[model samples]
Target: MRYTFLLYSDRADSAQMTPEDWAREKEVYGAYIGALQEAGVFIDTDWLHPAETATTITRKHGEMRVQDGPFAETKETLGGFFAIDVPDLDAALAWAEKCPAAKTGRVEIRASAMGDD
Candidate 1:
């Protein structure tokens, strides 16, 4: 089965980290990605730009409405995601545990919809 891991974190808090801390965090993530690739569990992954760069679009009364930033305000913001093929939820959770965001933020692990196949 394939699982989608949605990583979320507080951009404001993360921005406060020192350069050294940021480098260390990136090193951890790089190691995790290397491990995943070696195990052939990595499908795809990417980091998103800050929410400030995001644009929201909606349809209101048959008209297109455009706005800035994410649709909602919250302490946590969507940071990145990874799609991985694993044997079961346990395996997926194991991988999720290694995700950097899991330390101070959140990692939402969900199985892909069957209809998506």
Candidate 2:
């Protein structure tokens, strides 16, 4: 089955990263991705721009409403995601725990809907 990992983090933590620190962070995550590929479970992954660049849209009373930033504000913001296929929730959870972001943030694991293919 395929699962989606909605990664979230405190934006402030990222801002504190030095150039070298950021580079090392990428290297660490790259290894994790590599591991997934070796295990034949990797599908896709990516990083997202800060929430400042986000545009939120909603429908209210038959009209579309737009907001300039994220729909809500919190210490933790949506960072990125990973989509992978694994045999079961336990396997997906293992991958989620291995993600570097999980050290300081969260990886929300969700099974893909049956028709997503």
Candidate 3:
């Protein structure tokens, strides 16, 4: 099965990190990605720009509306995602738990609805 791990964190918290801390954080994520690749389960991964750069679109009453920033206001915003192929929910959960974001933020694991597309 394929699962996507959605990473969420507060941009404000990241902005407060020291340069050294940021570097270390990147190093940790690199190591984690390396592990996933070594396990041959890494499909794709990417980091998103801050939510402030996001654009939201919606349709209501047959009218299209465009708005700036995220749709919902929250302390944590989606920061990145990892797509991996694993055997089952247990495997996915195991991988998710190892993600760096899981420690400081949220890691939402979702199985692919379209299968291996």
Candidate 4:
């Protein structure tokens, strides 16, 4: 089965980290990614740009409306995601727990919808 892991974190708090802290965080992420690759569990992953670069589009009444930034205000914003194929949910959950952001943020794991292939 394939699962999508959505990583979320507080944009404000993440942006407040010092350069060294950021570098260390990146190193941790790199290490985790390397481990995934070595284990052959890595399918795809990517980091999203800050929320400020996001755009929200909606249809109101019959017209399309577009706005800048995220669609809604929240303490935690989606920072990235990982899509991987695993034998079962248990294996997916194990990977989620090992994610670096799992301690300070959240890693939401959802099985990919059926017939996606």
Q: Which candidate has the top score in lDDT?
A: 3
| Model 1: per-residue Cα lDDT at residue 103 | 90
Off by over 4 Å in 2: none
* True-vs-predicted CA distance for residue 63, candidate 2, Å: 1.2
Residue 87 of model 1: what lDDT? Answer: 98
Q: List candidate 3 segments past 4 Å from native.
A: none
lDDT of 3 by residue, 1-117 (tens): 999999999888788889999899999999999999999999999999999899998887688999999999999999999999999999999999999999999999999999465
Ranking by lDDT: 3, 2, 1, 4
Cα TM-score per model: 0.90, 0.93, 0.92, 0.90
The deviation in Å at residue 34 for candidate 1 is 0.4
Q: In model 3, state the lDDT of residue 100.
A: 98
RMSD of 4: 1.8
Pairs that collide, model 4: none
Deviation of model 2 at 77, angstroms? 0.7
Better of 2 and 4 by TM-score: 2
lDDT of 1 by residue, 1-117 (tens): 999999999988788899999889888889989999999999999989987789999886899999998899888899899999999999999999988889989999999997784
- The global Cα lDDT (0 to 1) of model 3 is 0.95
Give one digit per residue, the lDDT tens place, for model 4 in 1-117.
889999999877777799999899999999999988888889999999987789999887789999999998888989999888889999999999999989889999999898886
Residue 40, candidate 4: how far off, in angstroms?
0.8
lDDT tens per residue, model 2, 65-104: 9999998888899899999999999999999999998998
* Candidate 4 ranges beyond 4 A from true positions: 60-62, 114-117
Of 3 and 4, the candidate ahead on TM-score is: 3
* Off by more than 4 A, model 1: 114-117
